[model samples]
Target: MHTLSQLRSGKLKGIKRLDLSCGLTTFPEDIFSLADSLEILNLSGNALSSLPDDLPRLKSLKVIFCSDNQFDHLPEVLGRCSNLCMVGFKANQIQTVSAAALPLELRWLILTDNQISHLPAELGQCHALQKLMLAGNQLQSLPETLAACQNLELIRISANQLQALPDWLFSLPKLAWLAFAGNPFCPMPPASPHAPAIHWQDLEVAEQLGEGASGVIYKALWQQENPRAVALKRFKGALTSDGLPQCEMAACIAAGEHPYLIGAIGQVEHPDQHPALLMPLIDGFSNLAGPPSLESCTRDIYAQDQYFSLENTLKIASSIAAAAEHLHAAHILHGDLYAHNILIGPENETRLGDFGAASFYTPEQNLLQNIEVRAFACLLEELLSRTQGSAATLDKLANLQISSAQVTISARPLFSEIKKILSSL
Candidate 1:
């Protein structure tokens, strides 16, 4: 969060990070003074539409974020940076991406909430690309050359115009987390006619609980239900990178109830017709881990001092797997099943939540469930890295990870089977 005054006064010299949000319409020449050391640069919330062609002079720059800007196209000068690997230009009006706009060593790229209809074929040349976000766009199809990116792990292509899923996309060896919910390939699910409706007038809002890409959760009291304290999520009522708020609320209602899932009491009937959910207030529970960092693009970053026993970790993992199995049986896919979304209670009670990425499917859509299994494997792998348990126990988890992450969809074990394996440990 360094200010322009500090940067101009040379007080931020030798710093590895610089964040400027002072309504700049042009690149600051003073930024070059710290070129030798700056590794992360954030210039979001500005009016700039382009970057200086000499951006490569910042030889150490590796990550750049220019989200919420006025850029109509990605800057082509980015490709000249030798060490640049992570580039984010979200929420822009980008309609075209030139062939040279991609970096050579790119690993993570976020072009979410844009108007891109086509991608440059040269994107396939980035052998190191691991994570990509292009959810809210008008893309009719993906570039076939993207199949060459064998290292790509997580991708979000929701809310797009794709009429069909590319067959070769399933063959990507490292793809684990995928969101293609609000697209043409998958038609919108019908609203649940049986779910209860709780009017907004019958509730009293309290303190804010938390917020995410989809909405804001708040602590509230249901005046009509014995004044019970509950959680209420008021959606942003706009299209997010994953998809629409209506779809997420519908998925939550369709998920019904499960021991390891957050209880969705009903939908809020508001005068404004804003989508909202009435849920059970999870007391004393917190996220098990934080979202991934710029460096660890696809991995969860747990608290450094937080340690969980192997038994507790296995219990949590089993609970999540059981809940996922329930969803699969209901023909629902919990697309964003990661530790960052799991709530950890004092006694290791687990509840898998956040239906923003959940989507409905038919019993015949077996591949989708297997795809979620890979996400479970990622969580299991993260837990394994945190625990140094018995040789046999560790070896068992290692093998389960292998089965869950099998690039071949059929080779991955069913969530039910994975639950059994975790229970045994």
Candidate 2:
């Protein structure tokens, strides 16, 4: 929260980072003075529409964030920043991204909540790219050349106008987390309502437990049948990068009952009829890991103090794989299966939640399963590194992981097979 006062008094001299969000209408000319020391410049929450061409003067600058601004086009000056690899223009009005505006060394790019409709072919030239977020855009299609970016892993293209996904998009060896919901070509979930409905008038929506791109989860009291606690998730009533909320609800309902899955008891019924889920309130559990950071673009960041015992590691992996296999048998693909999405209880009990990126596909689509297998392998590999299991036990998990992560999509073992190996261990 750098202030104009300190910046003017030379009090912030030689700082490596600068955050000036005072609702300014233009870029402060004084920023150029820190060109020698500034590595990150965050000018978010401003009214700026463009950047000065001399932005390259910050020769060491590595990151630039201009979110919540009025920029209609990605700044062309950014291409000249030899060291700038991370750029964020989220919640801006950006509609055009010039080819020259992208740097070849760019790794992470965020353009969420923009009005962009097309991308330049030069995007494929960014071979070093890893994470790309273009959710909430008007992208009709992706350039086929992007398949050349083999290092690319995580991608969010939900809530877009994509009519179809490219074949190459799914075959990328490193693609672990991907969401392409809300597209015209996505499959419609089958009609099946196993979970019953609970009227909204019976429960009070209280303090929010958490929120995601698709919906908000809240802790509520169910006063109708049981005067006990429950978790209520109300959809945002808008298309997300993963797809429609109704689709997620449908998957949850069709998912049936599984001990490892978060219990979805029913749906929410209201006069306004907002799609919501009634779930068991889980306690004494925490996320197993955090979302990937800028540096670990495609991998999760587990807590430094968090390490699992050999038995606990196997138990967690077995539970998640069983749940995944169950979903597969139901023809549902849990598109986002990263470890960060897992919840761990005090006794090492595991539960799988978050259907935001889940999708329904035919059993014949073996490639879809293969794509998810890569994610499972990545999760297992992470667990393998964090455990102190015996050499034999470690060897078995490693072999299963290797088979799951096979580069040849056709060569990867089914989750059922992977589960067998894990269960035996």
Alpha carbon lDDT of each predicted model: 0.87, 0.84
Per-residue CA lDDT of model 2 for 197-273, tens digit only, reads: 57778897778998876788999999875587999998876555456677777777788889999857776786886
lDDT of 1 by residue, 326-404 (tens): 9888888887888898998999999888888777776666787888888888998888888867888889999999899
Q: Alpha carbon lDDT of residue 190, candidate 2?
A: 52
The per-prediction tally of clashing pairs is: 0, 3
Error of 1 at 295 (Å): 1.1
Off by over 4 Å in 2: 211-216, 234-244, 266-276
| TM-score, predicted candidate 1 vs. hidden true structure | 0.95
lDDT of 2: 0.84
Q: Estimate the overall C-alpha local distance difference test score of candidate 1.
A: 0.87
**TM-score per candidate:** 0.95, 0.92
